[model samples]
Target: MECFRIDESGYTGFDLLNRDQRFQGATAIAIDDEEAARLIREYFPRLQAGELKYRALSRRPGNHPRLLALLAELLRAHKSVTYVCDKRFLLILMFCDYAVEPYYYERGCNFYEDGQNYGMASLLATAGPTLLGKSEFEAMLAAFQRATKEKTPAALKDLVRAAQKTKWRELPEAIGPLAQYAAPECLSAIATEGVTTDAALVVLQSLITRMEVMSDGPYRVEHDQSKNLATYHDLLCRFIGHEEEIELRQSEIASFKFPLKLTEVVQVDSKASPAVQLADVMIGAALEAANVMTGLRADGLDPEKLMPLYAEDQFIHLIPSVDFAEQKQFRRGTQAAEVIDYFAANFGPKK
Candidate 1:
């Protein structure tokens, strides 16, 4: 049976719509046991002190080349699928103002009141960088700080409800009328069944697309573990018709008699799985690369700074060019296709 490991960057829950939201990404790598061992052995000594995986290590200057090389190796040596989201674009996709059933509105508002919505985190994260020295964002930043401290669902609803009532600071002249959206309601809709469905689309579509590209198998998916992502895991299990708890190992799935063609999903400690750690590394660079791929960083930063990370001889050379490879020919499922259409209609990132 084939195996794959998955890892993620950034939070996807209530944090997904914050003004200071980092890029949210997921990476899948198909690596065999032998190669996984080999990577662990080869990169172990070279890893910096206190570096657990890509997240901590990649933040430092000296480690950039190492991560680039690791990604290059994965690209060359294995089948991989990576998706890094511009959560800002995603928010627009989510709240595009489509008509909804009265129940859908209630669901959205209930999720908001229940503190289950993540749209605000994503929105703040999206807007924070640009308004760095601005006043209105500073006010929102303060509000965000305060909001983050609200632990109860009722407290969250109070915060969300406070949006229009609270007098917000003036926007930076440069931001223009777009800043009018500073209202709390504008940041995130209390998610409804319709909204949650839209929010889940990208994640589900990305995974389904990767599965299609990789072909059907009794494949097992091992992902990095997180407590906040319990629902996300349940969503995957629901899709595959697998109702078991996260087992963290392939042997556990095999013993349960689940079919190999259908994916068996589990979440494990990244420390226990080298491939999951490598997926972390790949996603770190990919997030910056995504900023370049999309127009987010276009006028703001020199994205070429990322070029050397995948420089020809250093790492990019190791990844196969495969100009005509049909390896990516697999098709998206219905929901995924619908999401793809929605994304394309919005500002989908360049591949």
Candidate 2:
């Protein structure tokens, strides 16, 4: 595994491969179209310059090489705003998406390719705490409400118990007061300790199912082939409580308003809190999961290959063929480089 170099545009020499050049979770090249062409032509020379390193430091075994390699390439492509903060940065980056989801631990490291694995959330703890699954978290909150009605222990709560204890049939009333009850320690306990109460357990299972649904976004993975569908149907039957025959009603799935053209990609914040963002990330990876899923469905392509993008991970991935780079190049109205210089001039560096 040697280092690779690409002297595109004016970005020549090892500076092209400088650590600073790789931001967030992507590899940035310093070159225009002509330089890009030349580097692509002599790509082997760059490989000879840098190493494709993998340093796995988890308590469990390392990830599969094929899966790990693909993830690495994905990280490189999307690393622009994504940063790695640990010793095994590359290895950890590959696992970040999976690590954030619920039940990841039960499935081991190789669960992304197949959406049927049941315990992806649990498996990720081996890596570290990064994401929180939203739908699952909501389901858990529901259970917490139920538990309050049943007068269960206070510890088995999501921090929103005051409102949750009310007799309101709708969830929002019960959830508001209990928002503060969501302690990290309590969540850690829940993740590590499987539920004893039936209500709580069902909520956990619901979280897992919701993750699959949300993850099926445009460019993200859609593991619903006929075979996968049966498993999915069974899970839905279990999650929804009772098996009313379901069918894909294309007309019923109304179109959403597009902030940008079909040919354009826009980034929208869900306005979710850090905890909520973590929950969504664990459920579907990042905002990119939603974006890719939308993009893929807009066109006609199977999206099972697109990986989930976690928010904390901080990179918005793009397919090389997409026009995102062009949009970035023409982003004159937004807070771009001039803003950075202005900030630097005002405050100075924090050395």
Which has the greatest lDDT?
1
**Highest TM-score scorer:** 1
Tens-digit lDDT track of model 1 for 1-351: 677776666555644446554467666778864677677667556654432565466456676555556665777777776665655445432322221112234345332221112233333345434534335344433343334434344534444443323232322221221233333342333221223322343554455445544745567777767764555566567557744342111111111122224467888876667677777667666766665555654432224654443422222110111222221221111122233234343322223
- Name the regions of candidate 1 deviating beyond 4 angstroms: 48-51, 97-194, 197-201, 242-261, 291-351
Tens-digit lDDT track for model 2 on 1-351?
A: 111111011111111112322211212111133332332234223332122222211111332333334333434442112211111122222222212222333335332322211122222223122223434343443453344234345634433443233332332211222343343433442333222221112222222322323222321111112331233333333333322332221111111121111121112222311211212222222222333354522321123543432233333232111233444333323321222223223222123
**Candidate 2 residue spans exceeding 4 A from truth:** 1-16, 19-54, 58-306, 309-314, 317-332, 347-351
Tell me the deviation in Å of residue 132 in model 2.
Answer: 47
Clashes of each: 25, 59
Query: Each candidate's TM vs. the true structure?
Result: 0.55, 0.18
Task: Give the clash total for candidate 2.
Answer: 59
Q: What is the C-alpha RMSD of each candidate to the true structure, in Å?
A: 12.1, 22.7
Q: Output the lDDT of residue 160, model 2.
A: 40
